[model samples]
Target: MRQHGLLTLGAGLCAAAALGLAAPHPALAAPDSCSYTSPTHQPTLTHGDTGAAVKQAQCLSNMWGGEPPKLPLDGVFDSVMLKKIKWIQGCHGLPQNGVIKDRTWQVLYHPALDCYDPYPV
Candidate 1:
């Protein structure tokens, strides 16, 4: 009976290992849905918003390059993101306000850093 119980326990452990019960599977891990691809429509993103779109905006903002380090890929529009947006807007000769409007999206997607005078730092 003791030997039979040991065999059963070993089998159960092996099954658990095979089933990946010991650690999280790749599929079980959180998806990279936060990586924003492109703006379908001009969704006005303000400082208080949070979602994949915001994350996408952050990613685009990072493409500006130089000065402040790249923002995290997390989907939150906090003050740091707001500041970055404002800086980008300034660089693109848009209003200094941190609001991501239609023009802001345009500048983000197509950064014409030379067209408008660089916003004062």
Candidate 2:
């Protein structure tokens, strides 16, 4: 299996070189439901933050559903959002800190299909 993977990787690299490319570009997260600025450009959000970005984060987090209860989408980062964020971080194997940093944002945009951790109370 390792040898096959290595061969595949080598073939991919050779193909990329032949095509005059560095490597394959990864797929970007799907279009989000919110109309706010693209999530990639939004600033980090944490406790006490509020605005379109917060609304955007809330909306994305809601997609996780039972991983954490859905948020209000009210553009306010309150306790509920904090708790939900922490659970989401845990599900993604990220720091359990409830801050919406870059990695957190990425996970929010692209959550796992199914989290292995049991839902938080």
Candidate 3:
């Protein structure tokens, strides 16, 4: 798994300033309904799990843009989904085990656009 370095605070601020975008304030980033509605009590999904929950996870992952591009919203948790989930987990500093736990679901619904960490697939 190749890990990429996170952007420094100064660099992030500079980029936001240069782009004329407001730097996101930690306190102002509110949790939205998307996170609330996403799957919470479903069993941990891994390779070969198929159903609505898997499809929902895939759909939410599209909101989380990153390497490997957007995935097809199929109702199967295959290898591709596993790789993407692991990547997202690593990006959010969670255990990169490809398991769709509660925290993983939260990150899927609300993602950072500038995830510097490279997902080691």
lDDT against the true structure, per candidate, is 0.65, 0.71, 0.66
Among all candidates shown, the one with the greatest lDDT: 2
> Each model's TM-score?
0.61, 0.69, 0.63
Candidate 1 residue-wise lDDT, 1-121, digit = tens: 9999889866865675565333112222122332465456558889889887887787676665433446787879998888778877776678989999888987776664232222224
TM-score of 2: 0.69
- Candidate 3 regions off by >4 Å? 1-42
Count clashes in each candidate, considering only residues at least 3 apart in sequence or on different chains.
Answer: 0, 0, 0
In lDDT terms, how accurate is model 2? 0.71
- Residues 33-77 of candidate 2: C-alpha lDDT, one tens digit per residue: 655657667587889998988988887777664433467768999
Candidate 3 residues 1-121, lDDT tens each? 1232345666775675565443222232234422423445456778889877787777677665444556676688888889888888877789989999778877766776656554454
Clashing pairs in 2: none
Q: Least lDDT summed over 10 consecutive residues: which range in candidate 1?
A: 22-31
Worst ten-residue run, lDDT, model 3? Answer: 22-31
